[model samples]
Target: MPRIKPLPDELDPLAAQLVVRLRELKTHGELTMRRLAAGTGYSARSWERYLGGTSLPPRAAVEALARLTGTDPVRLLAMHEIAAASWDIRRAESPGEHEPEEQRRSEDEKGERREQEREQGQPPRRLPHIALTAGVLALTVAFMAALLLVLRLDENVAPAAVATPAGTAATTPPHSYLCRIARTDGRWSAGINNGRDTEISYGDTGTDVAEAQCLLRRAGISPGGIDGMFGPLTLRAVKTFQDRAGLVVDGMLGPRSWKALRG
Candidate 1:
């Protein structure tokens, strides 16, 4: 059994859990990295990165591991969903840090053209002033539309915490949610939170997270502290409950996971 490296301290919590679970599965099957690479059709270096928490493993790679270990792929796939969302969030938050190769190539080409223009004593092409004004107007309209959509969603979903006005330096604190767990018809319900199918995951902060945390405690899995924040501990508790209840362990509180948690 190859020793796995410690996960990065700054790794997304959900992604960290996925890597830990993958490591556990690897150890349970007594499979070496090289063996996993060969069986999964991925390079050993790739497996190292995946298991080491430096990279998110592809769904195909995870499925291949399940196949080789004779384990059900459904649970692993559920975990993948959470990890994938975390990976996407990281990428979105640091777009410039991980620019795509094609985008880099395009930028380089533009830079080269600008250098050539300078060498030839020609001014670089610029957009027309009218075009720029039109673009600004379009952007303003789009922003307004997006703001309206967000307001509509907030009205429909749940009450939102007060937001800081645009161009303000002050930040508003996140809302604190309390769990009001109650037993009704042999099932559990959070009286304050009423969404039966709302999907909550790591980084979510609301009554829904509090509701899941309350149910997780009811299931005898502590979600760390029920602070209404769906952090790493909540994710682990969710996966544990999912595994015990024979539900997919994707770590997200989806419809099926919600059903299991409620039941």
Candidate 2:
């Protein structure tokens, strides 16, 4: 027998938006979907589904595309949300209560039978308590499995903290910082201190160093590209900005650096 292929999942508006963005990027770069799939570690068929808006692309897939295209994932996520919201609204307006008439009749018949049994001056039928217990146990096991999967995904996807310099005491403020950053269509915004007033794009490489570079550039500091890789250029720019702002010149972009950048 020939192997059967799975049907494509129906595309919702949000999925459609994701497809559009991915296609736009691919077109501008003159790359094919197969090329993207190969580069991103996603299967070509899966890429087709993702670009066709037939399904939501996994977070990893989104990140891979962003990185490959040298674009930011944050902005892409915002568009996804907008599309999702519109899809949700349309669903709400449509008729979702489509229970089969035969199924309703079957339920009514069962209810009548129960009532009739009660009227006969006899004890009501006892449901199989064991079945209910077994069901609960099965549900609990399934829930636990799902929880574990989510935890694993988080562990894998979450960014690790940047290593602080050695000899930095625990009492001292953490050497590395995490900054909230935003990007839209390859353009990034200035970073805000304490994640406040910061409209971060989803799945952004939200490392503090990356945020610092974005802020630096916005403030005319221009600490090189927003590659999320902190290097000597970034450090030099941070120290220069710190000196001008009369803050500690540790060459680390911290709270003081953030404040100075914002100012």
Candidate 3:
């Protein structure tokens, strides 16, 4: 078994927790990445990324681990959901990124509202009445500041396992953890790397062809062996895999076929 890499410290606290728990369960089950791949249909390399926190594990991976380790799927799945949600929110909140168009529009609307008030002479009236309105404005600002502070504190902390309603927390549902994978940018980390789209056919031999062969073999259509050669056996294997993958059954490996093979 390969040595496990340390979980990334920079991961969102919730995601870090999920990865740590997965590592504990994987160790408790005494299953190597190879055995896990054999049992779960995910590649050992995929498990490496997932457990190392370099990539988020798919829902199927989570469920498989829960089943193997006898952990409460409901709770683990909730953690997975919260972790995934944090990943998305972090990406959205990346510093110095372009402001969302909707938010930009919202700012413009606020400016327009302020301008309208000014044109209506409200500013003048408010200026003359500042002594009366000052206390109200100060109180409003203080309240908003306190509210923002609390919200920011919440953002910095990891969410609890249960939801609080009526001041009581209950376990979250497993389905609540269900979510879509991050954008197309996350595909490579998800084991769906489609970097090279060269047309690979018979006699085309290299790392690219070998990867295709590996994916084919994993799908139970052996390409003779992973010798990095696109020989006759490899061609037949590609066609067979394409057929099963609902592809065009072309002997050549292209983008669509590569996507199917990786997935």
Candidate 4:
């Protein structure tokens, strides 16, 4: 797998969410940029721009990635919509390179229309239309802003899982891990990853997290699902297990937790 560069630090939070999920999907599929390009019908350079957080990806590209990874595209598509909306909002708030030119064109058009109306001895007939348009636009923008705010707050609390046709929504992704617990050399193993002593906490991610999740499940605790993401539920599970096993209940998985998990 190619080493993915870190995303730009100034990226919007909503956009960051989509990009992170995309990176996770790529990791899960074990696909490089070239392979992803070949499979998804996008240029490797474009993929770099999208995955690097320099540019937002199109809806089609996002869906293509989901298909290539053999994952359902619904959640990805919803995320894309939020990212795109957030991008549009940010762009509208910022001045664009073409703003000056567009403003000049708009002024010239208004001047010409005024001159024509003056010559025809007609009063400005566009006032009502412009007022109505502006009012509608203002309302739309306000509603979108409110919606985005609510979504951000909800996401911070709990990430919503997309429901599939066959089942209800779940806290984890559809993919699941099959625990292959076994004893080897007097140490326990779950066959997900040989990651002893790897420190993991909330917001951490990778196969190691997945391994911990698998072990937690085998020990009769739920880590919210083996989706490779260490979120709040996973942290709670770790703490619960630690308390039960008479270890430090710091909720940080380290060597002791790993040993206990493996044991």
Best by TM-score: 4
- TM-scores for the candidates: 0.38, 0.31, 0.37, 0.41
lDDT (C-alpha) at residue 168 in model 1: 35
Better of 2 and 4 by lDDT: 4
lDDT of 4 by residue, 57-81 (tens): 9887987787566465655677776
Global Cα lDDT for candidate 4: 0.73
- The runs of at least 3 residues in candidate 1 whose Cα sits more than 4 Å from the true structure, single-residue gaps closed, are 99-263
Give Cα distance to truth, residue 249, candidate 1, Å: 38
Query: What TM-score should be assigned to candidate 2?
Result: 0.31
Task: Give the per-residue lDDT of model 3 (tens digit) for 1-263.
Answer: 66777765657676887898889878866677776786567899889878888778976788767644434555566667667766655554453223543344454775797799888878332233556456545654554454344334442244445444484335432221111123254332112223565679866656676666666766788776555656556777888988888889769999898777545
Rank all candidate structures by their TM-score, best first, as comma-separated numbers: 4, 1, 3, 2
RMSD of each: 15.6, 18.9, 19.7, 12.6
State, as a TM-score between 0 and 1, how close model 3 is to the true structure. Answer: 0.37
Q: Considering TM-score, which of the candidate structures 2 and 3 is the better prediction for this target?
A: 3
Clashes of each: 2, 1, 0, 0
Q: After superposition, how far is residue 168 of candidate 4 from its true place, in Å?
A: 25
